[model samples]
Target: MGNAIGMVEFTSIARGIETSDYMIKAANVELLKSSTVCPGKYIVLIGGTTGDVKVSMSVGEKYGGEYLVDTLMIPNIHSQLIPAICLTNQVENPGAVGVLEFYSIASAITAGDVAAKAANITLIEIKIGYSIGGKGVVVLTGDVGAVLTAVEAAKKQCELLLQTTVIPKPSPKLYETLL
Candidate 1:
């Protein structure tokens, strides 16, 4: 079994709804407790195994502008960080180096699923977080080779099916030829 970590955020309510819908219906995910970190905003936490978790979120009616400015308040006594830090603190066995960070939560879930199915690796845990670009980020720690191979598979899958990139040209540049 292995673990995964990642996070993503969306700016627009429409986009967030789309993403959250994808996760709930297309991915058939279970919802964890919602967070009250952001005022008027809801942060839902959810996870399971490969089949259970499908990384997704929605932009609520409230916007998260500058909300992240608030410093995180993690209680010191036997908190969640302690366990995570302790677990990763140990040295990995041969062929079991923990997977680092993945580009997106979707990709990470896909990678973990692919690894479990194709490589017979188990996804012991998963962590999701918000990315700097407001996109989802996932971090997975599991079998070294399995994680790496899964990353490749997930990347390929993303390239083939998930990713949507847009390139924009300057308005003046486009109008120059017309003028």
Candidate 2:
């Protein structure tokens, strides 16, 4: 993982775009993800050294104003987080499975990081926006104990957890569908 990952979610596309541009110009951070999510929201994800990410996020927050819905600056994030967010982490056979849903992308990412660090688990996916009405979802699979621990850790990060579940023994069909 990079030294840090920073994200800013905005309710206004115009403000989000402008703020993202300012962020990139203000620091030496690499733009990871930048696009409009569901419900007309805009999200900007960047990565770099901790100092650079903090500077970029500060610039973004200054420019975001009221349009900013959420901001996240996670230094030394879990190694699996970025890949899961990008939907590139693959699990051939899932064991116990856990899912966490949140109202904000920033919160979801934070929860995922905490969960991953709390237990030995595989992050299956971290889906944001799309058909889920601008919400965020994180999926993980591991031993029953690990899954339970991961879910517990994730729950602590969100004010209102939209949904959280742990399937102790998922059916093969379920794995086929989710993975």
Pick by lDDT: which candidate is best? 2
Q: Using Cα atoms with residue i matched to residue i, what is each candidate's TM-score against the true structure?
A: 0.35, 0.95
lDDT of 1 by residue, 49-68 (tens): 44334232222212334332
The pairs that clash in candidate 2 are none
Report every candidate's CA lDDT. 0.35, 0.90
Poorest 10 consecutive residues of model 2 by lDDT? Answer: 153-162
The residue-level lDDT of candidate 1 at 91 comes to 22
> Model 2: per-residue lDDT, tens digit, 24-113?
999999998888999999999999999999999999989999898888889999988998989899786579999999988888888889
Q: State in Å the error of residue 121, model 1.
A: 1.8
Query: In model 2, which regions exceed 4 Å deviation?
Result: none
Query: Residue 62, candidate 2: how far off, in angstroms?
Result: 1.0
